[model samples]
Target: MPTRAHGLRSRYRSLVVAAVAALMAVLLSPAGAQGAGSGGARTPLSEPVYSYSGAVRESVWVDTGLDGDGDGRDDRVAADIIRPREPARQGRKIPVIMDASPYYSCCGRGNESQLKTYDSDGRPVGFPLHYDNYFVPRGYAFVAVDLAGTNRSDGCVDVGGRSDVQSAKAVIDWLNGRARAYTTRTGGTRATAGWSNGRTGMIGKSWDGTIANGVAATGVRGLRTIVPISAISSWYDYYFAQGAPLYDGGPDWLSGYVDSPEALGRCAAVQQRLADGAPRTGDWTPLWTGRDYVKDARKVRASVFAVHGMQDLNVRTKHLGQWWDALAEQGVERKIWLSQTGHVDPFDFRRAEWADTLHRWFDHYLLGYDNGIDREPMADIERHPGQWSTDRVWPPRTTRTTALHPGSGTAPGVGALSLRPARPGAAETFTDDPAQSETEWAADLDRTTTAKAGFRTGRLTADLRLSGSSTVTVTATPTTSTAHLSAVLVDLGPDTIRDYGASGEGITTLTDRSCWGASTPGDSACYRDTAARTAAVDRTVISRGWADLGTYASPGKGRPLTPGRPVTLTLDLAATDHVVPAGHRLALIVAGTDRDLIDPPGSTPTLTLDLSRTTARLPLVGGTGAFVRATAGSTAADAVSMAPGARGVTPPHPAPRVPGDGRP
Candidate 1:
């Protein structure tokens, strides 16, 4: 999301100026600031002090309100207009930009500690860093509003996304009409921008991202741009991958929303705002409006600049695919950036870029600023091993498909093998005891251990990149009536994985998974309706497909150790971004459960993995399926490799022969 890393680029220059100002005020006044002398006028200003960098002048506050929805509740808002102290421009109402968010009351404007941290470069870094000084000095009139239900704003917090939109409109109206702090020579509306939790555009990412999407889709006139950074397009998939219910992430988020510190010390009262299991209301209710953002993202008419993490665990790139498809159908001006960094890090930078991008967009559409933003590439993908490429659009126009065939004991067999196809009829089987409670792949524990088995295509010799589905088909027979199977696709080694996903089955306190069909209620299952299940009546072949929940059922009246009866677990591997070196190998691991990356111990039904007949289908690109040959090594030093994208390639990264962790 971020165009630049935090602090790497200056973001606190204004605070330093403010500190100087406060110091001068201390020296010039009867008493010095920071208690340097007998406390001068110890009276704190009723309103926040304002300043514009690059200028000697500072504008005071102008408070105003409007009936944005005409509901009688005067939504009080504030603005600070900063012009160059030197001279005035002729007949030009400067384009205004502001961020409307619900992070805190008064949009964090009244905090003095926020004022002092502006560094020499004009960036605000400290707790009280204000946007007014940063943007206003740059010829922008900045306004920050206290969203409804906070401070003097009216109405309740529509966590479902309604009040925020109304507040945005009212703030805009006030900006155009009665902003009392300064006079405007040129007259027209201005641009708005925000980052992280702010209500800027229908920007996607975490919770704020979702609301942005919802807000923009409303087609509100003032909403000119959307930057959904690591936002969840599909709530269900955001929480659970491969159809495994996220039993933890949901409740924790709900708890935070209900008890946000803004409601005084009434955490309990906030928690009680909506009873557990209470249906969501307003524009967000699909049942009422029959319009779901996931189902119809095209409703968002605003130009969008979406940012996604290639390794975002919580909000997978797959969700970004959903957004892409919708935006494409809408034919809206859209661009996507897939990066190698973590969600939060990228997002922080994305906001500034978003702010800049919106400025150009509004200038072009609203103010007629021809910044050539539309001429930029439609997609920017940070490819693995470190490189960046631009595309006119995503799913690249020149993508070629290849298949990888799976085999036993790392050896090539006879007949034609796919470029990246599954070895037909090949299977692996193993026993899973839910009672054992083992660790799984990556971070989540739901994919706990039965017997960890993985296959690797020896190092790419050439860069191996895939952007679609990765699947595994296993014929499994449960000693018990039912089994729970979770599958994950990891980049392997230290550099491939990014930190943004759930690490275990236990309810996570940081995110929500309702859209991904993983909901939690007080640390218990809230989306049990989607939990995998099976029939207890017969010893049948239950072909439970992956990309959805696995089965959980009583094996039968007796434990069916009948061995011969076969069941199948078709696992849908999560998408990945890996750069297998000339010597490294690409590995696919299968387990009864990956405890670390999936459900926790004693929390859910257990799954048994049968490795004997497991088969994986891998997609390979470049050339007709059989252009390359593959080989495996019995020992580390003897590992295989290809003649640099020539054909059968061996894994570049050597796997330690002795398994340090029993669970792959």
Candidate 2:
């Protein structure tokens, strides 16, 4: 027989051994040993978690501060939601993907311009695009909200102002249980987003995507990531470049154009504020500063996935370039996709690959899956149609800024662009005509009666790649107090380029259809096919820049110039990623006015350019070696050997510069 203390010690040892055996059993089990968390193995994005046909659809209205309709009550933002039925029925929480747009019931979305479709009970049966049809089966909820003052939402269109951003922010607050939402505009029983897991991601294109950028800058709590495609980071950049207005009208006109449901007269106050806020001088005011997301990039905590077309003239590449630079300065995690198409959706350009990539991104961020996407390359650049290259960084880390100077040439108003600056020659002069368009200015470089000055590099022996923004600096004297300055970069190669014509931006609609998702009665799975509009031309305008000489010193103040007094003007051209192919020449055209893009002054001004002091600084990949190898035959010595008064030869039938001033 053992003593009481001895018996107690023996029992404790037996209990410890039994517990260890039980833990080992669990570790050896196949189902329980998948992952090291209580949540078990992570769900794969390719696996369907719920029935697509059985997803639930519902609608609610979130309250905002504005009384847009002036009914004496706060405005309401309408939200339409679609989610898997199994998750909602079983009380299991799921993540949310939201798109806040003003075009749902108006201009529509994507290449086809598809709008929202409703059922008999006024519930949304079909959400525009394939987001709802594809993501519902993957255990995520898709919510589409009508921005305040558009479609079913109750408010005036503020045009990316406070109301536009707040309406979207209110929805995110409600989803996270921080704000209140109701079924009707005036009053109803309060509703809670209990089915949501409080994690949200926003994605959209153009104006819709703009809202995403605006909201993310606010540093909202629940928003995990944002994908802004061809989006505007600054409203001022969209309407004005530097100190010049891109169009005649300001944000007032844009507000009226986008506000379809509300009568124009009703929102006259808002529209008036918009017009007054954006002065004709193009100075930075409180209104534009409030709308600029790049300035507030430090407040952003969400990861960004930016997409833009290098040839996009509507929104332009500067918006993305500046915003991307700001984000990088803050050490934010970011990814980018740069394409050659003009203002086009990636779906139309790279359908299957885009879908798969987007799916993986959403799964990793929203669903907490440990996918290897984040460790992969951060950029995917499209060199040509259907040809893409991935790199660890955007703009390539090896890029360097190289300055090209105007050298002696025989042609009037034409010269060779060489690495060495030439001695001062007779200044090239051109009269600014308000009636002349960009097409007429670039038609013939060597024409005797042209209103623009052209400079070019000789036929390239190798490919020269330009990867970033280009700057044009000029020292000139103007005949008038005010003048408009325009600079264009041209690729003078006899090849077919993307035709961003007067009607459409390098896309033509066809009768045939292609499908991306399952179909319902309200929403069709198929859409019309589109073909790339290509044009065979002698020279293609790759990028353009403009400035008003009056606002050279400060955009807020205009100073009159003394007659024949030289003033230096520097203009930043749009960012680009293009390869000037072998045997092709890179041309730079400097003109006084761009009638196609901006409103011209009342009087014409003659500008005399100091060719010796002028230079165009370009960001080229591979530095000086690339430039030297490309122009080995036509050396700087050749440029110096040209006779002072010799005329340059002209290429016959130069391509017309496409008109890009108007709204898309």
Candidate 3:
């Protein structure tokens, strides 16, 4: 009963079985001793083990679904890649570490002011920062992308809009084999990311990190995690603060600043859209919504390792605070590092610790390594310069809002900040003066000034630690339809602190260089070392807020008030975590027109505050009972003079550095 057809079928089955056995034998041999990474390549330690000098370096133009330049073609993003040449040639796939930035070409990056350089064949030779020098030699591929409309890319600058986000996301798609790319801008052959394992980690600072946040919000499949350092979550918060323009004509100018030279006359239309969409009246338009990534955090598939400076006045702390809160609400995996510096990258301030933690984070997430990062504390906070501590979470979960009311004091406008409310109809008044800054308004805490109204608590008997955002609710009557108000929470005491208001923004760059990873002729891992800039100060502004009375009702809508009519305006203070020592007193200064932080308003109006109605809700570690006990040993004299009343020197750096803040 053995038919010829049956014999042929049996022979075929035998051949298939033999082939599978041979394949399994080859896979399980001694040649497969590449460690136990489920994702292919493996990194055994926190240091680089693979070869960096022999890495394969190349460039590609990935196609994107954007017509930012309107040239009848899709915009192509420029990406420079560096990976281990031997492993990549041997058909070994690896995960990617990407940094997509607009600053790569125009302003440079990091402490050294480095820009990417290419060789004769248009292959990358010089890579900015230590990312390539460090990670490329650690079984990882480093990809530095020029955001659309910047550097060698083809497009118009859209700032944080669709073009900027989609272009970067398209590169991840290509790495995952879902999109197309080519060797050159015009054409050559198709460039395939065949050596990649479709896993990526994005890391950057400032606008570069912002792009990472934007891409992460898209829930991009290949993006495993993001390390956004001092990044913005919402573009609206960057240029406008609650319907108040932080400065005039922000969108268009920033777009043109980062755009390539080729985008000269071609991007006028895009620039016009930016200018037209962001109305001066500060209305929340469709343009800002497109740029707001915080609202879309629920769609994020990537774990976030957020690092922010509590004193980062440029991008501000609210961006990270709100973004982190949103991420937590979604129950996303997160870790945080809060520094006492300003607008600074941790690599420059806390180099060793940051590098080690970053290495472990990438290993755990992207490489499927069983590192104990999740078991470690969730927060690494630089409590003071050269001092760091860890916590289970940020803002310490024990935080509660303690409302402190302002009351009458014997020293004229110098009022008292206390748990008990002031008598009804006890009002204080001040005229808006654009000339006086927060520095001037906060000086001489016990003295009366026409420029501001001050309230201070008695000398604290115990340490009070504030760890979150604060809000000031002002119940006031304005003399005119247009009114601008400012509130500041100050730590009124002398303390040796890292001078965040110093010329270096709390970090001084030294000429002496330190190497992090292996160095090549063109690109080195060595950078100028930095140290903390310390200062002796009597008073330090802990947190501050500003409000345009026209937008009192809502942040999106601006409505003018009736002259002499009272309106309650609540504004958000910047987030913070500071410890007021046992002897220092906490003070709240209410003023008009914060000339140092915000642009001057058009009209100057005098405002009268109903002390009984106005109050500050602080995020103290413990509630009112804690505050009452801390300041229990209080007297009228202690209230009159804030503690640590030493001779204070004026810091060299006093206000926000505009053009300088955008760089580095």
Better of 1 and 2 by TM-score: 2
Summarize candidate 1's per-residue lDDT along 350-395 as a digit string, tens digits. Answer: 3345445544554344333344667877776655323467777555
Cα lDDT tens digits, model 3, 82-179, are 98775555567888999999877787888776888988877789999998887777778899999888889999889888998987899999999999
Q: lDDT score of model 2?
A: 0.76
Which candidate tops lDDT?
3
How many times do residue backbones clash in model 2? 5
Name every residue pair that clashes in candidate 2. Answer: 149-155, 410-646, 410-647, 411-647, 411-648
Candidate 2 vs. true structure, TM-score: 0.87
- In angstroms, the error of model 3 at 304 is 1.1
Listed per candidate, the RMSD to the true structure in angstroms reads 17.2, 8.0, 7.7
All candidates in order of TM-score, best leading: 3, 2, 1
Give the number of the best model, judged by TM-score: 3
lDDT of each: 0.39, 0.76, 0.82
